[model samples]
Target: MGGGPDKEHVLITLFDPEPKDITGELRRRFPHFEVTYVQVSPSRKDAEKAGNEISDDLWKSATILITLFTLPAKPELVPK
Candidate 1:
């Protein structure tokens, strides 16, 4: 409970069909950091219907997060 500010949590999201590959890339890029991949299916009617509300929930819990996209020019998708 007293790890200090040096210990921070980072949340990352990928807006693409292949979350695994995106996550792997992140790991490679940031070898010293710990990464957790959240898989969300846009094709899922139930999830798509919920929209940003779900993303908002995840963003609230994240400390320092980054969203990696399949298309480099498509803009990095943040949790917000």
Candidate 2:
């Protein structure tokens, strides 16, 4: 909702094989919000295959992590 990661940071990973440009869509949908897409997979298949291989840096910066794929996330991987 704000201009930088300090106020709002969202990590989104889509699970659709042919994913839409969600970042672009979110920006369009919420033009007032300074939405940033961090480490989002290029495609649903890529996200699904990546599993919980998410990096520590990504988790550290993300205030909220939303995964479109139905994989079970490791508790340690979740942001506190």
Candidate 3:
């Protein structure tokens, strides 16, 4: 799929493979936006490590990041 300015790149990291109906809700709310999912380990350390390991480009392009873990907003992930 081609992504343009109008496209919404949502990045969601969750411990469970199954989305708790959030995917449906997002799709329903923003029908035009493209949603993406990233599964991370339930362990806090593992999840944080995984998130930190993501390439800068990917993080920069994401429109919104939703994490199920307790990690605070990462400055690196959120572009200034």
Query: Can you give the TM-score per candidate against the true fold?
Result: 0.36, 0.45, 0.65
Give the number of the best model, judged by TM-score.
3
For model 2, state the Cα shift of residue 38 in Å.
7.1
- Clashes by residue pair, model 3: none
**Model 2 regions more than 4 Å off:** 1-6, 17-21, 28-49, 70-73
The best-first sequence of candidates by TM-score reads: 3, 2, 1
Residue lDDT tens for model 1, 30-58: 67545655544445443443334345544
| lDDT (10s digit) by residue, model 2, range 1-80 | 32253455566654444234767786677664444343446566666446556666655555556766523255565444
1-80 per-residue lDDT for model 3 (tens digits): 22465676777777889585989888889887767777778897686687776667667667777777723347755552
Report every candidate's CA lDDT.
0.47, 0.54, 0.69
Distance (Å) between predicted and true CA of 42, model 3? Answer: 0.4
Off by over 4 Å in 1: 1-8, 14-18, 41-61, 67-80
- Clashing pairs in model 2, backbone N/Cα/C closer than 3 A: none
Which is the winner by TM-score between candidate 1 and candidate 3? Answer: 3
- Per-model C-alpha RMSD: 8.3, 5.5, 4.6
What are the clash counts of all predictions, listed in order? 0, 0, 0
